[model samples]
Target: MTLVARIRALPADLDDLAGAAAAEGFGMLGVLAREWVAGTQRFAMPEEALFAARDGAGVLLGIGGVTRDPWAPALRMRRFYVRPPARGRGIGRALVAAALDHARGAGAAMVRLRAPAAAARFWEGCGFRPIDDPTATHGLEWPGRG
Candidate 1:
């Protein structure tokens, strides 16, 4: 059966999701947790926000966030991860769509991310193209932004 996920702005809790990500050898989620607890990098900057996807049973399926790039005046997509079991369920794509929509709504003309080598195809499939920029490995410009 296909599962439905509810995507929304992150809440104050994500320990379970962080643990799941660690089990799969992904440490970004743990960093997200620590930074969240420390009151740093909460994605609270203007035009920035974090998103979480939860299954019908309220289990975290994935997470992604957009923030202002520290080195460039552009939006950066970060801390994106989908639980292993939740792969192929459209959860990751949904998270990306949500983040992109948020970025566009906030007046961003483009979005960038440093995708891991293994995730190159996925990011490309999501409309991001590989780039040589130091601040990001891939970028996507909003259509008609010019």
Candidate 2:
């Protein structure tokens, strides 16, 4: 399936995607949903926040997005999800690639994200190494793995 990403500026079609992502093995899905709602509201009223994802046949197959960062030249990939029906097909991996491309265009120097322990091995296959920092969490680096 084709993967794409768009701005979270409208948030008109995210509630469903959030629910689907929550069903995955990711533990931070709850927090991600809460933040997405808040960010969606903010994005609607403001112009700073951004969200992007991959849509397949009018359904959210994958999700990856970022908010405006004033602190540094980096984008925190707040959430990444692949629907159950869309899993095991490398959709998650494609979505991550799309998200990283978006972040780079937003003038971000680095992109950070969290992956569930269950998916850690998968991310490793994506070339992400665990950092020494406790707060660093989980993420896969690009062009290093695969």
Candidate 3:
């Protein structure tokens, strides 16, 4: 099993993933980014990201992303997606591992995300706890890293 691959954000990757997002009922990141690109004072910061999982013949299989703000103590899980064919193969678990590693390396005090409600159970299974605070993004948080 190819277990993982790390592809940094490329413009083309953004285009390729639009279909995935739509199919899975997640936000269209390319549309968001394109709109952002068109806005004044908005710039793309190549996010600190990681992707892992198996490819047949020992290629990597997982997909995930993390954002690290150098001066801020927060880490944001930008996105995570596993190809439909790879589901149930532990690829999601592997991707989570890599994303968390990205967080830790970025000196994050905690990791946060606004996962679509459909992914609530999966993310909960990945160890993210729902927060009671309604104001927080998607009302969730990963326990603070010590």
lDDT of 3: 0.59
lDDT of 3 by residue, 48-106 (tens): 66564557764333356666433335566655776676688778878877777766665
lDDT (CA) per prediction: 0.82, 0.56, 0.59
Candidate 2 Cα lDDT to native:
0.56
C-alpha TM-score for every candidate: 0.88, 0.66, 0.67
Error of 2 at 9 (Å): 3.3
Cα lDDT of model 1 by residue, 1-146, tens digit: 32433334354557778788788788998887778778888888878888778787767678888988887778999999888898998888888998898899889888999988999999999999999987689999987773
Tally clashing residue pairs in candidate 3. 16
Clash count list over all predictions: 0, 3, 16
Runs of candidate 2 with Cα error greater than 4 angstroms are: 10-13, 24-30, 39-56, 67-74, 139-146
Off by over 4 Å in 1: 1-13, 143-146
Candidate 2 residue lDDT tens string, 36-143: 567642423232333444555666566655544344344555556666877788777776666566655545555555556776777667666665545555543344
> Which candidate gets the maximum lDDT versus the true structure?
1
